[model samples]
Target: MFVIITYDVGEKRVNKVCKKLREYLTWTQNSVFEGEITKSLLMKCLNEIDQIIDEDEDSIYIYEVANPKNIKKQVFGQEKNFDELFL
Candidate 1:
């Protein structure tokens, strides 16, 4: 599955959260990450994030491609320097 993750974390935890996400996704912008990930890997990523964040103070948003055939994903604005594929 493909996912776009955006996060808002406390100042102290921001670096920790960003580091965790880099293991699973591409850092697209400040506070933003997107890439393809397996369900198990996604869960692992979230679980790691869950440990680092204070639930009441931090927020994580996940946008997924529910139906690949019907939905098309597009990126507008400054183009990414890397190719779309990860490997």
Candidate 2:
């Protein structure tokens, strides 16, 4: 499965979340991650994130795409080279 994970987290904890997520996903943009992950692993990732974020002040959104080929991504500004990692 393809997953897109984004978060709005408190400054002090943001880096910690990002670091943990990097273990399972590719950092596609600031506070945003995308990659293929098993459903079980996705749940594990969410659980880990839950432990790091403050519920009242932080939010995380996860978008799942069962088929990556069906999705379209378009970039308007300068894009960093994450294709190698993503592909």
Candidate 3:
């Protein structure tokens, strides 16, 4: 599965979340990451993130693409080519 993860986290805990995510995903933007990960690994990642974030102060969004080959991505400006990185 291909996953895109983004977070709005408190300043104090942002680095912790980012560091953990980088261990399993590719950092794509300021607080956005994307990569291919197994379902089990995805669950593990989420569990780890849950531990670091404050529920009321932080928010994490995960977009999962079960069939990446069927999706088309259009890039503008200087965005990195995620297709090349994740496909």
Candidate 4:
């Protein structure tokens, strides 16, 4: 599955959440992450995030597509490509 995850987390937990997500997805932009992940991996990722976030103060949104080919994105401004690697 292809997942796009966006989150609004309290300041204190931001780094923890971001770091966890980076392990399973690409950081598409600030507080935004997207990538193809297995169901088990996604579950594990969310479980880790759940442990890091305060349920009362944080929120995470996930959008999923069964097929990656169906994703059609349009960016009006500068686009971020987090998939690039730097050595």
The whole-model lDDT of each prediction reads 0.86, 0.90, 0.89, 0.92
Please write out the lDDT profile of model 4 over residues 34-66, one tens digit for every residue.
999999999999999999999999999999989
TM-score quality measure for candidate 2: 0.89
Candidate 3 on 1-87: residue-level lDDT in tens? Answer: 999999999999999999899889888777999889999999999999999999999999999999989779776788863435656
Error of 1 at 56 (Å): 1.0
> Which lDDT tens digits does candidate 2 get at residues 28-81?
788889999999999999999999999999999999998999999998897754
Give stretches of model 4 more than 4 Å off: 82-87
TM-score on alpha carbons, each prediction: 0.81, 0.89, 0.86, 0.91
* Alpha-carbon lDDT of model 4: 0.92
Top TM-score model: 4
Comparing 2 with 3 on TM-score, the higher-scoring candidate is 2
The deviation in Å at residue 68 for candidate 4 is 1.8
TM-score of candidate 4 relative to the true fold: 0.91
lDDT (Cα, tens digit) per residue for candidate 1, span 1-87: 988899999999999998899889888778988888999999999999999999999999998876556666577987562325344
Q: Candidate 3 deviates by what RMSD?
A: 3.9
Model 3: lDDT to the true structure: 0.89
For this target, which candidate reaches the highest lDDT against the unseen true structure?
4
